[model samples]
Target: MGFCSYKSFVILFCLIFTPLTKADLLSATLNYHQGSYSEAKREFLQLAHLGNADAIYNVAVMYLHGQGVEKNKAQAFAWFSLAADFGLLDARDTAMLIAEQTDNKQPLDDAYNALLKQLSFQWYDQQLRPELNASPALHLSPERRYTVEPKYPEHAYKNGIEGWVWLEFDIDKSGAVTDITLIDSYPEKTFDKAIINAVRRWQYQGNNQTLPYYNRSLLYHFTTYKGKQYEQSFKSQQREYNEKISDLIDAAEQGNALVQYYIANWLSSNDYNATRLLKYHWQQANANGELLLRSAVNGYANSQYRIGANMLRGKYGKVDREKGLNWILLAAQSGFASAQYRLGRELLNSQYVDYAPNKALKWLRAAAEQGLFSAKRDIALLLFDLKKPMQQVSTALNEALAGDNEHPQLLLLKAKIHAATGNSNDARKLSNSALKEAQTRNWDQSSIRHFIATLP
Candidate 1:
């Protein structure tokens, strides 16, 4: 081998023998910005080895600029290719730009392919698997032993589509993932299914002595060319609307159910000054209610449910239970899960409606079958109240708990079931867990404390 520079020797020595420290990306980037190029390159390489895409891209930049090591276009192209494989759109674009500009593309292409092979799953299994297997703590919170990245949708890839998805999930006592809810997504529904499916296969460290965790959130980005074009398009549309709120109003007035629902939902929100239209209508009495009613009449299921729910709570004008029930029934008939859940709750508890246990159960089951965790929990509570068989009640509770193991109401219900079954130790444990959760949430803890005191 040819003689290497002192910096290269140091990097090689550290990689072969030195134990890597947990240096974050921010610190490494700061070092680079502060002109500590050698230090930054070393740190970036360490992070890149652990499959950090940003660090890999930064390393490529350093190689391209000769910040730490001698400038080598081949090495920079290889690093950029590795980052691109890890879903860094900028790195993909940079690599392509370099390939196009270089007179001799064959060498760069070969280097890129070779780098991809080295970074593939086969390489991960050969090099990283043993280290991961030896580290038990990697399975704990804020760290994962293994993760499968969401696949880029084939259609999106071909069309260069890009966006993000925010997800909330739960990890059960068995360390199995559950309750994967899509909190929000840009370009709605595009990457939701892919992200949810990938997250479903994740595992965490389980401790039976502790309650299962809940509401863990993650945001995933799917990008090509860093999504600038799409973002610019979105901003342009916003600017158009900002300049002409009258267009939106005209659309809503033209019996466009979606536009009416959007305006109604925005008006009902507390952020009245967020948009030109909302600000313009802020002083109008019952503007949201009127628009919501129009949207409902125009056959928008979400608007029907929202208006009905608001009416039931006297948010529109008065508690028109009859009208609210009818609207909610229409939404439920259209197969909206939230409407079914709400209608079930109202049928069971609303004083305006005669208590209809059978009807309530039907709606609740309908929602539960659609994977609504709240509906499942309600069904469990209803079954327990009806003095149903312990096995049936337990099954419902288990299903709900699978989705939301940390829900205080579900914990308390489980505690009561344990007490009734003469499992006092289990009852005490669950009651205490419920009490802690209630306290953390600033909920009324008096009832939970009283229940715990009654436990043996």
Candidate 2:
């Protein structure tokens, strides 16, 4: 009679608790076997909610492994305890094992509190699936490529622009853009044409169909940098020139060191309040560079080199060669080509290092390998200085001239080499040609002229 009662209770327990569909249970089983613990946990949790005995066991396994849940021996015991409550034999065995390992009559004291938190958060989890639906691009074809274009008007916008345009487009099955329209980028007819012209050329691939049909809406924003709706025609030139100053001024005023650096560089060449602006921008860039160095410590090689070089040049500041050299070395090691060249030139000119020639040669060679044309020319010049006999110099010069024979620096070097070796005719020919090319390109011509004058 006792055996019969136990057997009947076992059958009743299985019937009441095992509500999981075969597909869901099978997915959980496959995931568990495949070592996809997080995925298995999700599937098992779903079945556990449906009162599946097997799923409850699997969820305990997930807790044991801390897969998508906190690793809590107590929580694992609690889950096993729940299954055991219904007279599950396997659950009874596992729960006893967990209890022994935890050394407790009940699961740990914190397990109940954590379980309460999980129950309270259940509604929050339920609301997440719909929110996920809004971002279906995650499940769409990964093979598809989307080209992004910023929604800037192709033509500049002027002030007094009104009206909203709507752009509706579809991504096709082939992942190409179609049915694109100008969606309220402008108000006036002229401005609208600019937006429409840009839209017609834009392409995209759609997700829902085998080929995209127009079904989506996109927004574009165009901001006016300058020009009021009724700016007189005479003020157009002023607007075009002064508009360049707006962002530069804002960045400078806001103490953005990077922008300040660029503004300083620009003002150094241009004479409009050039000295004052140059000093102010350089000071800000220096302060910003110092702050950045503390965090990155030799990072931002360009910033280090720029600030260092400015200090070296003593432009509106005291010169500090030691600090400049240290920063320059950092920049050179980090592969800033300009810094590499400058460091090589400086160290070589100082001639204090034991292997100064080899060091300069190595740095120049590195910069040249990166396809920096000036660095290539520098290497050729170094080879000319090092190689014995006129033929070797000629070979190096020819190699340097291969890609850019018309470059002023190489031509000047060639002229010098030819003149040094008494090839007056070749020297005169090369120098005269270089002078003309330099003048046309608006490059500095004084050095080329000097070489030509020395030819005789």
lDDT of 1 by residue, 1-456 (tens): 221122110111111122213344555776899999888888777556545567788989998999988998988998998888767899989989888889998889788778776574345333322221121222224335458888988887666555567576666555556556664564568889999889877766645433255546565766554234445644545554343455556555544556565566555444222233355744565566666665564456776676565555455444557766777887798787878877887788644546798899999999999998868988999999999999999999999999878877789999999999999999999989997876664444665778888886
What is the C-alpha lDDT profile of model 2 across 92-112, one tens digit per residue?
Answer: 788778767665555454664
CA lDDT, every prediction?
Answer: 0.67, 0.51
Question: Residue 416 deviation, candidate 2, in Å?
Answer: 3.6
Worst 10 residues of 1 by lDDT: 7-16
C-alpha RMSD between model 2 and the true structure: 26.7
Q: Which stretches of candidate 1 lie over 4 Å from their true place?
A: 1-250, 267-287
Worst 10 residues of 2 by lDDT: 7-16
| Residue 36 error, candidate 1, Å | 71
